[model samples]
Target chain A: MHLAVDISLRQGGFTLNASIDCWSSALGVFGPSGSGKSTLIRVIAGLAKPDSGYLELDGDVLFDSENRIWVPPHLRGIGVVFQDARLFPHWSTEKNLRAGMTLETTGMFSFEHIVKLLELQPLLKRSVNDLSGGEKQRVALGRALLAHPRLLLMDEPVSGLDAKLKEQILPFLARVHRELHLPCILVSHDLPDILRLTDRLVLVRDGMVCGQNTLEGLVTQRGAFDMMRRSGLMSFVSLEVDGEPVRAGVRPDEIMLANRPVEGLSARYRKPGVIVRLIDHGPTILCLIDTDEERLMADITPDAVRELGLKEGSPVWCFFKAGAVHSFD
Target chain B: MKSISPAEWTALLLSAKVAFGAVAAVTLPGVLLGWLLARKNFYGKVLVESLVYAPLVMPPVVTGYLLLVLCGRNGPVGGWLGRTFGWQLIFTWQGAALASAVMALPLMVRSVRLAVELVDRRLEEAASVLGYSPWRIFLNITLPLARSGIFAGLLLAFARSLGEFGATITFAGNIQGVTQTLPLAIYSALQMPGGEAAAARLSVLSLLLSLMALGFSEWLARRAKTGRSTHAPCR
Candidate 1:
């Protein structure tokens, strides 16, 4: 099912005036903190009400302030998994899982099925706190799924997880979208999450939709550069090679020394630029390179620096493959 | 030990009856007022809160005197009740129980109010989403979660009623085998010549009963706290 939301809410000095009319199989709300990412989802879920707005889910008008019609969150057929797991402490993992299910919506997604889907069988007897961060998030996902929500809203579902734990849970989340045939709006600030989970991205900035495009298309836009500047980073353009579409993402440590236009064997996306500055960082120096209105951070070892005779104002031909480009928010 | 005399037994039985009756009288209104103060934010919230706590802070005799004026036979409400329902409250066992209920109402309300405030609004929202009506939600979810606090309040109210003195004596008068609750009996025993042993026994009994009630209240609070999950389910 598709969801449509156009809501405006004011909190102190910040005003969130968000309007979205897109329909996607999966939509990702990608933004930095304080960008009203959570507020948008909360408004749609009825957790936080917008002062004046209208919400229609799957062609049903869930809320319209003008009409004074408001459908509460539970009746909206939407499920939300907050960043914090919010598992009931008093309940066992099984009981907490069961809490999301009832007789009216029975058998849509069974308790056993969710337990298996999230690999929750081992955790059934454990208290919510007894489980690790990854386990709690999995249980939270299972609980939301058992409720049989028409559409799911996940707010940074893995923000607290370490890299390894995040890797562990990402596949399960992907499977939920695939197997359940559920439309989802996933909110996060992490680029990897968007790349791994969603095709369509909605970028929010200062409580407004600054841009909306595919992950690939948005990264190519000027706003991407602006966002990168705020992030103290730069973009490495992806190129097409041998009829195979290749994308390149710049890592801060991958650049090597090249004084002249060295004939690279097969590296794609060759860009000629000058080293602008070098900041000493003990064994390595942070080399700032300027290429076509873009600044990239490259960490080169002192040995590589001495061998290449690299210095500020030195012209260099950076050879990197287009396959490394990662299109994420 | 030995069996108590009939006079002492009479006082013990009377106190038990008064405490029970006081609980019955105060529970419904106590709960209502507690919920009102806890959940609502209407005008005069502060004034109502102060008025409810007045008996707790004010001299009990003053509260008893107020009750006497309002619930006495010739008083406006008392006269109306007498005319319509043939109910008379002044200087009777029922009047003593009413006085005790007034003295205990604030304690009952404060505990229940605190519990009601702690009931998560998100859970209530979750209940609504689950197709439960507001009344059903209150009965099933809210009440169960707040039960420990309500029971603590009830026990406190009952204990307060058992030991109620100034209000009961002032409003109902200390009549032998009638409105003479434990405190009133103890007061009377202390005044009578050669009544030290009986007074000491009654004091010990009061102390034991209060200690037991206090212990139970602490247990209930601790149980409620331990039952709390670090991450309670979101609405």
Candidate 2:
């Protein structure tokens, strides 16, 4: 399904002006906090009315300011999984799931299929107030899926979760996309969370769509890279070694330093580079190394930096394993 | 532990009947108005709110006088009702029930409105996305979640109705078997010579009734609180 949105709205002092069109099944919206990510999703979900512009999904006009056509949220057939998993407090898990089934649609998602897909059989009898955060999110996903929505919208579904819970939920999101084949828009401020779900991203900043590109493509853009760096996205590089293309993401924490290239080690990718800059982080130092093809950032401890006498213009051998490299086509 | 007399028995039964009638009369409108006050924003909201709560702040006699002027035989509303429905609200038990309902409405609205406001609006938004109509959302989600507050409001209104007097006396006249509720009976018992024993006995009954109502409300509130905490998996 193709989705098109071009909308502008002003509330108080914050204004949102964004326009994008996407045909990809899973589109990730990445931005920092207070960056109008939620506002965009709210507009598409019909929760917030835009001052002007038009929205079309799969050839249907969802909203058109000039034409004065606006479909209410319920009739739009768009399902949203909110960050807080806003389940009805008075209902059991089963009832909450059943409440999402649209009256006019049936046989799309059966109760048993949803229960098994979300592993909700054990939680069906439990009160919504009794479920954990991860469980609540899972139930919310089931609820939305059971609605047989034409388009799915997720707003920071795993933002507040710990590492373990996030890991547990991300796979379910991927499975939902793959198994259901539903078009979805996932909004998050976390780069890794968006990477886990989809590679196609729309970068948003200051209530505007900066650009839409792949994660690798985004790193190459100057302004987008600076925004990503400020938001804690590590530098990624795509290179060609021995006439074979290689794509790898270098995490700031994984890059180790050595004065000379050591032999008898399992680390596959070792490159000799000159230290271009050294930035003092709170507890560690961020050292930027100028390799032949690209620049790599290494986070090294202050003690090690002092021991090695590392400074700007120093030559160092950067070592990392092939396993640490995340490759994409 | 004196045996109750026949006159006292009639007054007690009448009080229960009047209180029940008053509560029944106000519940649906009270809840609707409470939800409107809690959720909707419109012109004259403050004026509407003040009018709803006028009975609570104004003198009971004044409220009674207003009700008499509005619903008396010669008044516009009373004349229309008499002509259209052949209904009479003056100096009858129904009039007493109406007066009691008006007196208790503000408290009922306050409790219910507070509860409705406390309900997480996000839940309603989620329900809207799930294809539930506005009325269905209220019936299926809002009302059930606001049950505890509604219960508290009902009990409070019942207690206030049982003890209503000043408005009841002015609007519905204190006829023995018709409009004399518990508080009115107590007042009547005290006005006669050598009626101290009856007055004291009726006062004790009123005290017991009030305690029971308050105790039940407290218990329900505790249960609702515990239910919320026990089921809440997060802080």
Candidate 3:
């Protein structure tokens, strides 16, 4: 299913002109904060009115400013999972999920299945406040799924979670995309979430969509690499090496005392990078590697630096597994 | 000579009757107004809110005088009612009830309005997506969720009606068995020569009734908070 949206809005001095046309089952809108990501999602969900726009989902006109056709959120058939779970504090988890379904819902996912999938049975009777951040988000996802929306709009659903918690939620997101056969538009600033959940990426900058393409295509693009390099969201382009792929990523904490280049199947891409700066970061030493246009941060133990005789002007080969280099754009 | 007088008992019953009558008359409208003020954003909303709350902060005597001008016999509305339906309100128990209702209207509105404002609109939207109509949403979601505030408003209105003195006396007058409410009877007892003990008794009853209403309101509010479920509360 394809969803098309073209909208423009101006609030105070900030003007947002954004448009997205995607055919993928899972699309990611990647942007920094205040990049109009929420506003764009709101417009798509029919929660916020755009000054002028046309939104069509699967050839059905949801909003056309010219025709004055503005369907409210309920009629639009789009389920939204806000950053905060936004669960009803007055209803049970089961009821919250049930409330999303209509009497006419046929062939939709069952409430029981969702409860089991989200592991929400234990939380069904508990108050919303009693649930943890991760559990609340899981319930929120279930609530949206029970609605059987044509398109799911999730705004930074896992941005608040730590790395491990985010990883735990990622599989559920992938399951929704795969098992449900539903198209989704997820908005986030985290590259890892986009990498884990979506194949298509839409890069938004200054409230305007600057790029939209496949993750692989975006990864190879100069602008994408430049943005990540500047923003501290590191990306290393992976190319096919032998039958598998040679991948690379920055594990800033992994650089250690290496007198010589280590050889093994684990080192996916070993490139000689120049150490441009060295600084003390508490107990460890932070080595700044200048790899062409991108600067990589490596956290090396201070003892490793002294043993390796590494300084600002030394040449060291950065080594990491190909798996660490995420295929996401 | 020391026993509770029949007239005093009648006055006590009449106070309760007027209070209940006034509460019944204003409840649905009070809730509607409360919801409207809490949720709707329209031109002149502030003006409408100011008008609804005017009786709360305005002098009770002035409000009673306004009621006299509006609903008194031979006045515009009173004249129309009397002419059209032969329904007279001046110096009647119904008239006293109407005066008490006016005095308590803002209290009812203010409490319920606060409750309505606290309801989460997202849940209401979620209900709409589930095919519930706006009215159904209000009944199933908004009203139940704001039950505490609404109950508080109801108690405040009931208590205000029970104690209403100035407007009740001015609009309906103090006939012992008809319009002499608790506050009015207390006033009468205080004014009568050597009626100190009777006045004291009436004051104690009024205090007890007010305290009871307040206690019930607090209990209902606490119950609502504790009973709130984990699911979406508003819708």
lDDT of 2: 0.85
For every prediction, compared with the true complex, DockQ reads 0.18, 0.31, 0.30
Model 2 misses residue A230 by how many Å?
A: 5.2
Candidate 3 lDDT over residue span B140-167, tens digit each: 8889888888887888889889989888
**Better-scoring candidate (DockQ), 1 or 3:** 3
TM-score of B-chain for each predicted structure, in order: 0.88, 0.92, 0.91
lDDT for each residue of candidate 1 in A124-206, tens digit (9 for 90 to 100): 87887698999989988888888888888899999999978886687788889988788888998875576567757788889
Contacts from the true interface found in each model, as a fraction, amount to: 0.22, 0.56, 0.52
Docking class of 2: acceptable
Residue B181's lDDT within candidate 1 is 77
**Best TM-score goes to which candidate?**
2
How do the residues B1-235 of candidate 1 rate in per-residue lDDT, one tens digit apiece?
4456798788887888898899899899888899888877999999999988999999999999998788888889888989999999987899999999999999999999999999887666655544446676666567767777888889989999988999999999999899987788889889999888888877777777678767977887787677665334233
Return the top candidate by DockQ: 2
Residue ranges of candidate 2 with Cα displaced over 4 Å: A215-220, A229-266, A269-329, B218-235
Model 3: per-residue Cα lDDT over A218-297, one tens digit each: 54456764564344444344445676654444545533325457776466565567887776645666677766545566
Question: Candidate 2, what DockQ?
Answer: 0.31
